[model samples]
Target: MNESAPQADMAEQLAASSFNTASRAIVIGGSMAGLLAAKVLSGHYEEVVIIERDEFQERPANRPGVPQDHHPHRLQDLGKGILEALFPGWREDLLAQGAYEREGKEMHLISPLAALQFPYEKDEGCSRPLLEWVIRRRVAAEPRIQVLQGHVAVSLLTKKAGSKLAVSGVEVRKQRSGGSRDLEAALVVDASGRYTRLPEWLEELGFGKPVAEILHTRLAYSTRYYRIPDSLKDRYSTVLIEGDPSLAEGSGVFSPIEGGVAETTIYGAGGHYPPVDPERYERAAAKLIHPMLAEIIAQLEPVGNPRGFRVSECRLNQYGEMPEWPSGLLAIGDSVCNFDPIYGQGISVAAAEAMEMGKALRKAAKENGPIREHELQRRFGRIILPAWWTIVVADLRWPGVTYEGSLSGRGIRFCQEYLDIVRRQALQGGDMELFGLLMGVQGLDAPPSSLFGEEAVRMVVSRSKQDAWLEKQLEAGETLGDFLERSFPVFHPASHSEANR
Candidate 1:
């Protein structure tokens, strides 16, 4: 059973019942971030217009505008909560539209130390198209908001306000009509993604370009769709093999999607590429840390040819650092900070930023004052700092990812060593809490600070010793039990205190 977007004019209802201090707002992207932003802006502005370049279909499908739509996407529990907050009942609405539910101990995670099955936690996974389609439809239901498709934004119309420049409107050219128009707006938001033309738009208006930090990992991935085999249909919903660069050069993922189809993605970084050819793509899964994915996919029938995608780098634009950053102009989503995509943090981070924007707008809503442009952009910029730091820290471990002066030498070493321990400890038995915390942080549910608690620090310190001993055993061709016996001969599994550090 699929849930449909509400046809009721809730936007009209809000316009009639409440007073609005702002006249119009324009969101420059129809992406997940833009849709969520419009949902928030609708409450404060009398009319919110979302400009998009693609003509959307009535059904769920991919568009040429979003190049990464072919990949498997997820709304981890943390992001799901944010979506539910913005659009009450979003989970239910999404589930009704053929999205699969992921819960319990359904993941088969492989690492360098040992094969691990994650403790059960609820989540949702779907194709990127379906997620975008549902969100777009919901954005259309608001009478105060309008989705303008087949129009490309050409330039930002700016005005010199005394000593400062402010964004006044946007100049857009219609793709269908070949006509151009100016859309005047008090607030202009750019969520146009990684390929955004904000750099050109800003420079033409005589503003300094924001500094950006980019790390090139050279990650390439090939994804193919499949029909789930009846044998594994009822057993588990996902199997992910985390790429262990030490043992293997690539990773593999097999998860259920809508329409009873499964999507398998094989990826590699550091100049490695998974095959896009059907025969070789199937063979690509065999190089994972485990052969479970290869065996599973062998029994299923693939629905389409494997398609290849690349994420050459992770970029974070420094907009707030500019003293002369224009007022009435702000950007969110990938346009501000785009991750490597393997972490699956992009969608969740966008949702979190939308919430921040809403929080900033509430001040204007209360005072009946015009929306504060510079303050809102700066606030949103500060809000994403924590996640931005977390992303930089993680990608530093990969080869060819240049972050030379950004992170201190000593700090980088400590994070690398600590994360190595976290991965090793996650593979050990009776350490579900340690693994869960790591997953939560990766899922954007828990803050990176959560991993630095007294208990966690103690655990890492203790595991550091264990990891050193385990390394020796591997060099000497000894087993995990051998290392345990040689190191902790007096203690067994019952000695939880030793493992707890």
Candidate 2:
């Protein structure tokens, strides 16, 4: 055989061998979701390639892909636990890098009527970039996982097998070289985040795109970083300075970050946008849902000019409604659902989804005959929907936010009743464990049902009359729903839709 003929035959044979290896998978996007997907796929697939359109950094730093990386991030205790389970000793790695293990920062859960500071039994958090970078490094160390940086996934390669659409592989293009290559794999995962083009691609292939449920609460965020003075590090702990939702203002959090620095992010809901200047940042902080944030910001040094970001509420991809989904393909993370970051639950939910994906993939592998791709997608959706409801519903209660769902009348009353309990409990300072538990559930450590349990509801009712602070606030004309409607009309559907709807 001539040199050219033999080489062509070898290439064809290799391509054939690549399909059934039972050890190869391709993942699109090298984000937190993508990296976590690779870690989960490491045990199941012998080799996993993560393709990214952005340049990959050896160290964890800010990049164009994740615009919100610079903002404050709180890895709820549940999220911390999930990461610990995923990468053993991950927390220790963070602690070693000057990431504070906050334990005694009393949580102040606020409502229009009252702000209750509870001595939390357990709570912790860290910077967003530091946490993402740490996890990315651990994932990259896996021998089976290889990150193909600066590459874009042009399209997914699928074939019709009998009556099923089987995902055979992916077509990718290298950014620097402008060269194209096709890689065959047993599975392909889409973790391309909120800007994912998967739905559009599916439409091009004749598959109907999944409908999106959007909660449009026109919100804007401005964030600035500060170096925490050594003396204030221990005394100055995490504080969730909030905006009075009833007042048409956004909420903010001032917390300790990874590099011995503090970060404050102020968000405005509806049309109450925070100006990208120091004076407006302070004014917004002072007038937030609670006024304590103003006191905290007054003591900090400005590390950088504030950066602004605007968001149009939350988005949930109803993948479960798809008529037909190809086997061996999965969507994860922000591509699956994106929640309002103000709730501080995004990281934890992502971790929870990753854990679920790992379990589903393992079960599929054990069955050996066929993969339950639809079931896997359903399982992922099940994990996301509850969190989505919590966030979208909360935003919808405000003046400026709008959504497709019915949130007026009885819905508004139900939310008001729930906040009534939240206000009372926050005033009495008697439900730290419960508050922590709710945070975990919101963070995806537990279910939403945990928040509305008989015990929690009873506690709210019992404390409603007894909370002096709440009673006083109510007497002073501060009701939860009224306060929210007045302060955050942007998140309130009726306020934005009355004229246009």
Candidate 3:
């Protein structure tokens, strides 16, 4: 029997409590966002159930829903800290399972002019499945949380009382046995990722879908894994070969994983992407920035054929501006907004969203009796918009990438000059303080406006001029190989011809 709605008086009493002791939270989809949502809901609700469409994985492994799990994934330092704050010792658990920490250390950053090899610091690098598994384990272990695997949520069950449209539960379909059932809850969270059908469901309920702002970049990621040498095992954690706009091609990054294995992924926007063919992949990667990456690829034995993913669209649902939202429902993570994966901001932003959602839920539980579903969704949307703009605006600079918004006269000039300064700073490498600031905003730690300060502008301008001059000299003189051989003793200390001397 389906659970009936709490009476008005009973709901009022439940609202006065410190937490929603009499209510339940039903989380749709059981990926990272779903699991994190479960954790947050578990603290406030009497029961938290996660409904997953895929079969249960008793061990740490991949699921059918997350196809990008096979590709390379990097968890930014911001995400690591956020995850730790949410679930303490989470990093330690991942590291124990052979996850690599590649930030600040073992990272080879190559610009058009120089190659920066920094020692590893603290960060998280693992397969998406492994990372998800760690979080899932923690969430699943919670006594108040339940994982209902092989249960596909077909539709949200709602109860209309006068003007209030509140979700009471969900109707689910069993994958294997073809059984159907209805699970009732006080609230529902949609963390069902980019391919979510929530909008259609809302439309079916006579609610106009939220306006979507789509920046269709036709972006694609091609990934392949290889066995690294023991000597190079400790050499560099990640090698980033940035793309040049002049070439109109792409960039490649090779991240070292556990057990002497490394994953290299090439990303291209539009149809100008790296080939899946092994030889062609090497050639295209060599042209990007670092020839050494291609050399490494040539030397290593490939683990398997390269897997490809096309992200043709990035959409931001403007739910914050909605006039009316249903009660007892919210959308978090990729279901709300999807960013370009090349920037590597997806996981970081998703984690930030989860943190925001948790804070909002806690605050609402304390003050309000029964939190209206729209309020939580709006707050979460408000927090994510600035970060979305930051990513979309910056990424729109690449040729062939599309943008829906407008930037008038001064705005256009300012943006052009701004990127020029950023490029220069990125190459010269002295603006760690500024980079830290920009990265913080990029990672959603700070507001987007924080980057537009006068001090930042000045620093970028002065550094950009210096970098530009250096670039001119390098371009006029020789390739990175010849220049390094002639000037730097460390990189090309002994040349081929001079070695005999």
Winning model by TM-score: 1
Candidate 1 vs. true structure, TM-score:
0.85
CA lDDT of each prediction against the hidden true structure: 0.71, 0.69, 0.69
For residue 400, model 2's alpha carbon misses the true position, in angstroms, by 1.6
Top-lDDT structure, candidate number: 1
Model 1: residues >4 Å from true position, as ranges?
1-22, 229-231, 246-248, 368-372, 453-459, 462-501
Badly placed stretches (over 4 Å) of model 3 are 1-22, 101-104, 405-413, 462-501
Worst 10 residues of 1 by lDDT: 492-501
Each candidate: how many clashes?
Answer: 2, 27, 7
Model 3: colliding residue pairs: 15-369, 105-119, 105-120, 105-121, 106-119, 106-120, 106-237
lDDT string for model 2 (407-487, tens) is 344444554557656644654566666566655556555544445444544456565554553344342655644543443
Whole-model lDDT, candidate 1?
Answer: 0.71
Candidate 1 lDDT over 1-501, as tens digits, reads 012222123222322434342378888988898898888888878888777888678898889888888888766555677777777776666689877777664677775677766544665667999888888777777888877677778899888778888897687777766667767777889989988999778877787687877767677879999887667675657888876653336878888878878889997776677899999887778867688889988888889899999888777777766656787888988988887777776777778777767766786678877566666566555555555656666666656555622444544555556777786666565467787788786676665555744455556657556646335334367654443334321312211111111
Model 3, residue 465: C-alpha shift (Å): 6.8
Window of ten residues with lowest summed lDDT in model 3: 491-500
lDDT winner, 1 or 2? 1
- RMSD in angstroms between candidate 2 and the native structure over all alpha carbons: 8.7
